[model samples]
Target: MDWIDWGDAPTWLGAVFAAAAAGAAVWTLKSQRDQIDEQRRFIAEQSMNLGLERQALLAAAQERHEAQARKIRLYPQAPTYVQVVNDSDDPIYDVHCEARGMPALHAVELAPSEGVGAGILADLVQGASRPYVHRLGVGREAWFHVVTNERGAVHIRFTDAAGNKWVCDDAGGLHEAGA
Candidate 1:
């Protein structure tokens, strides 16, 4: 049996082995690069999806906040006075009020009267009887005096500048009025 000697291999064989190793190295490098690119693309897509999801969540939260902020409440502070409060950032217009068995009340504005006084209260109550167009700004209120024999419950309606109607029923439920 003859034993093969690697040290006495042909020069061509050595060159061939060297070329094969080089080719293998290049192929491995290209495979690694392609895998890295694919991973990068996946990560980029995931990031974009996360961003869109975050925006959608933020928009939903904003809508909830706005709905909560734009509510109006009617409280009978006294037998003669009904306080109307605007709790939103937007202005409320065309204020109208009706109780169980009382005359329908309309006002120029149902806004905060800065100081509590007889004269101011009387003016506010008197103003509601006349046809007037006004706005109640944010965090403001006005008081209406009731001279009715029946003031058990009251329903108030108003609109924003954007024409969105809001109604506050005696049950304390605030909701959007119909179109």
Candidate 2:
């Protein structure tokens, strides 16, 4: 029986096999590196997309919070006067009042708990002859007297600290003007 003679194989044949194995190993390493690079790129793109989505959600939440904080209310105090109240978290400025058959009155500022009174309220009503701008702090009140009694609605205007305009009517309805 004749056995295969590995000992008779040429020395160059062993060198060829070693070279082929080395080439395969290099090819495999390169393929693995390319796959890893592609995965990294995909992960980076996904991360960027997630960040953009998070920013949009945060902006929406901020807008909703600001809307809630800007809420205002007007309340009728009595037969002679009405009160403008800030029902939100922010401060309002440049408060102005206008009623039928009466001159418009301007107020300086009003905070969250602060309010202004229009018409002949109580003794707190300031005289009509003097133009006064009042700054009502939180939970404070200021009054302006009415000189005439006419059968018409009253309207109040003001700006928030953020420069947003607000209006309120005698019907107790409050709205943002020019929004």
Model 1, span 138-162: residue lDDT tens: 8777555554314447766788766
71, model 1: CA deviation in Å?
3.4
Q: What does the lDDT come to for candidate 1? A: 0.66
Task: State every prediction's TM-score relative to the real structure.
Answer: 0.52, 0.45
C-alpha lDDT values of all predictions: 0.66, 0.57
* lDDT tens digits by residue: candidate 2, 29-128: 9999999999999999999999999999999976764563346555544555555665556555656566674644422333434334333332344433
- The weakest ten consecutive residues by lDDT in model 2 span 114-123
TM-score of 1: 0.52
Where is the poorest 10-residue window by lDDT in model 1? 103-112
Best by TM-score: 1
Which stretches in model 2 have alpha-carbon errors above 4 Å? 1-70, 104-134, 147-152
Q: Candidate 1, residue 114: CA error in Å? A: 2.0
In candidate 2, how many Å is residue 45 off?
Answer: 18
lDDT of model 1, residue 127? 66
Clashes of each: 2, 3
